[model samples]
Target: MTGSPAIPEASAASALVFVGPMAAGKTSIGRRVARELGWEFHDTDARIVAGHGPITEIFAEHGEAHFRALEEEAVRSALTGGAGRIVSLGGGAVLSSATRQLLRGFPVVLLTTTQEAVLSRTNLDKRPLLKDDPEAWGRIYAERLPLYREVADQTWASERRPKEHIAAEITAWFRANHAPAEPIHGEAKDEQHD
Candidate 1:
């Protein structure tokens, strides 16, 4: 965020966040969108690895809750800082109540893909929750859909199309939905989370 877009002066709290199921191209889209807007791109999962150890190691030694706590703090720091940045959150990041509440004010874009579409791209070895089975992927997607919907400000399907196209569409959506010159601000407690 050293060199920024000419939009306006605002705190790093105004970052655009991407949330969705694993392998839904959240990282790819976030990076493209950030580049499109001349902003920095960050991935929460990568941050977790950098701050802590490997995620599976954390899950093995500490447990999911401990890993989740780390995720919560990472999400908080990412949001509280980095105004001209786009963040791709881990699939389970929104599971934290604090993360969900913190997401209330930001533009949380939910990217979705059909099970068939992601099959070729998703690496089961990397995603422990996938359990090396497509059924498990489906089940997890089903379980997280409601929570994703609850926090999403907008939704887009990341089908078999190119990543750049999806990113361009998101950029257009923001241009149409968000005020051109206004800075994205934190939500007032009196206002609705949407």
Candidate 2:
């Protein structure tokens, strides 16, 4: 991590969008938050793998551009349809300007942590960007930091903590701001931030 100033938390959006580097706890946190809110949970990476095939194979056969195209479609579909759901995007999903634009009215949470924190969580063999290199991970994280910040309505550190606690914080925010009419939207009242 560079010595940049910490990003301030923003407010409000139609749905919750989680963005960050690989192994950043997006899927786990998103799932817990969605379950807490009784809404659906969608992970764009999972969708891509399900609909197309292995992402590595896609990159091998076609290219990164083609895989990103597929990602765009999956992200778009989830955004347009997810009114009360939590969405977890692939680490690089925000690289596209159009995707960033689409995220404007959505509650984006940038889940970030130091490389040391993610070392245990990371699956080196699977991520093309990291290529199992710690330095490569840092470089890519530095490159994507600005893009992640651009769309994030909130930012949270998931290092050495329970994902449920993080999910609870996000759930509190979503409930405070949106207050969805449905019974399953939770019963919290106060708005708190850390």
Candidate 3:
């Protein structure tokens, strides 16, 4: 991904976290919301790529267990950065209890898309889990849906809507329910370009 402007500390710290199943438009919508809010957008998956190389490579080299550890670390760093940014997490990021706890008090939105939509948006070959069994993708989604619902403060279904529309919905939700709060732990600064 190309670099974007660094988000203000205030915006970064109060970030809206997006979580959901694969191809649910989390990353795309998150980016739109961040752009609309004039805040920074960061994807934990992207950070993982920046830190440990591509996800496929990580899984191939050290296996999923190692990759998950890296994902957890990336999530922790994004949370602790204290920027009111918009963070798009990997589909399985919420599988970790630690990650869920870390998201407490943040505006967490879950993007829900249909199975058909998911299958259409994702590449079967690139996804490690989906490559094996014909039913693996469906199985994984069914298993993870409950967990996603459990952690989400708000949920948005994005079956056929444009990403911008979904992002507008998120922004509307934020305007209505979000209460601006002072930075927790106060780690504000203009860092180098993201």
Candidate 4:
């Protein structure tokens, strides 16, 4: 109940990719899930930062198009990197067709939040697209909902749940629906819970 339940050794090799709108808690939930499963955790945004530069700087210097191109490349690296890991993607990571194609073989979970929740959790200035028109963030989110749905293998709304509860739900879903493959790097040991 506190963490992921024991996964049997026979489960298939698989990876969980978390996607959602800004402030939907992908990174937080992903970290929790990865910890519980004893799997590696990677964030495409973080990879983007390591590979290129800070996202804000990328957007400011080159522009949205350039930033998105980098995002696509980062996503590809994360997806093909192999199983037994949780990958958290940026809010707008789904906007690229190539990224969606790369995710085809991975189990994608969409973490969703209400528009009001999104507005409350994030400031418009930090997000390049919303800096000039804050209210437009909601509109953009509404437009992208369908796109997110189109690519999601499963959807979990994180608006009301605690992070552990959300992680538990995802863990349960993975257990019942799929098996974990041998860890691409090494076997992941189950974590000890309090």
Candidate 5:
């Protein structure tokens, strides 16, 4: 029997990538989804921290540009890694055009939260950008919203919902839309025609 076209083995169809502003629960929710799906989970921010050091230290000592470069490297690594993964990107990871271009090959999900929700969930001490001015979160999110939209294949509003429920929704959507392709049964190479 004939079968539909096969997806590239290394394409984004093999992974679910989450992107959004700080406190949007990308890491937490992504972990849950990956666990439920029995897939690997990759958090680019965590990769940066493990490889370099704390992000705050990176910003304080090296500055945002340096941190962004490191972030892009981490993003590239996660996206290019073999599939069956849920990858969570830092809020600012989308700022790089190169990173955004890399994301175009994958299934990207945007997790969003209201200002009130984010303010309530945020630990300003850890966020270098919002440490001195928490209100800056609004302005920053506004500026980056377009970029987030540009890369996202699906937008999930994560405000005021239990992470389990949100993860379930994403999981269901992923399974439904990105189910593995069936093997082709037609045209066996070894068959001898009469």
Candidate 6:
């Protein structure tokens, strides 16, 4: 055991993952948390968009199943990188059983907001699923609540509060609970200054 490399006390899935309905501010809040923690940040939806195209076009041309497949791959790539960071999943990412399974053992947070809040918060025209049927988001949220709760280690309401506050609270919880005794890989970047 002499001169052996130090083993990580935490798992590869130790990164904090954010999940919830659309317009729940997961990306913004997760970015803030990453900045505060000095860790990397990845938004799975953005990954998908970058690799393929706009989500609306993907849904229209290839359909939901195809898009979900791409989304699953994005989730996998983000979490399996063996780094402690913040990852914001697509709103419908939890609907994939593979994604849900991969989320196990990871620090997952669910950001919940009312349908009214979501409607008033963002543009629906860009949301493919909600463009023609904005009310469908409520039903989708209801249907997915159980899955969200299943993977979420904690839940935070994004309603009537600044995203910075939510990110700070989540970051505090992460520091108190899941912060490694030391850095798992290397020094976390000072993302705030960058």
What's the TM-score of each model vs. the native? Answer: 0.83, 0.84, 0.84, 0.84, 0.87, 0.89
Off by more than 4 A, model 6: 1-13, 184-194
Instruction: Kindly report which residue pairs in candidate 3 clash with one another.
Output: 11-84, 12-83, 12-84, 12-85, 13-82, 13-83, 13-84, 14-84, 15-84
Clashing pairs in 5: 12-106
Worst 10 residues of 1 by lDDT: 185-194
**Model 1 vs. true fold: TM:** 0.83
Best by lDDT: 6
Which regions of candidate 4 are displaced past 4 Å?
Answer: 1-12, 181-194
Worst 10 residues of 6 by lDDT: 1-10
Arranged by lDDT, best first: 6, 5, 2, 4, 3, 1
Error of 1 at 130 (Å): 1.9
Give lDDT tens digits, candidate 1, residues 73-147.
Answer: 777767766456687899888787777877776778999987887677666676766655666877888888999
lDDT accuracy of residue 66 in candidate 1? 89
Best by TM-score: 6
* Candidate 3: stretches off by over 4 Å: 1-13, 179-194
Tens digit of per-residue lDDT, candidate 3, span 1-194: 11323334444337789999877888788888877776677789888887778788888899998888788788777866755577889999988876776677677999988877777767877777776764676788889999998888998898888889888888888867873654233222222334
Better of 3 and 6 by TM-score: 6
lDDT of candidate 2 at residue 177, scale 0 to 100: 73
**lDDT computed for candidate 2:** 0.77
Backbone clashes counted, model 6: 0
Better of 2 and 6 by lDDT: 6
For candidate 5, lDDT tens digit of each residue in 9-58?
A: 45757678999999999988998888777777888988888888899999
How many residue-pair clashes does candidate 3 contain? 9
lDDT of each: 0.76, 0.77, 0.76, 0.77, 0.82, 0.84
lDDT of 6 by residue, 56-133 (tens): 999999999999989988888778766777889999999988888778778899999999998887799889999999
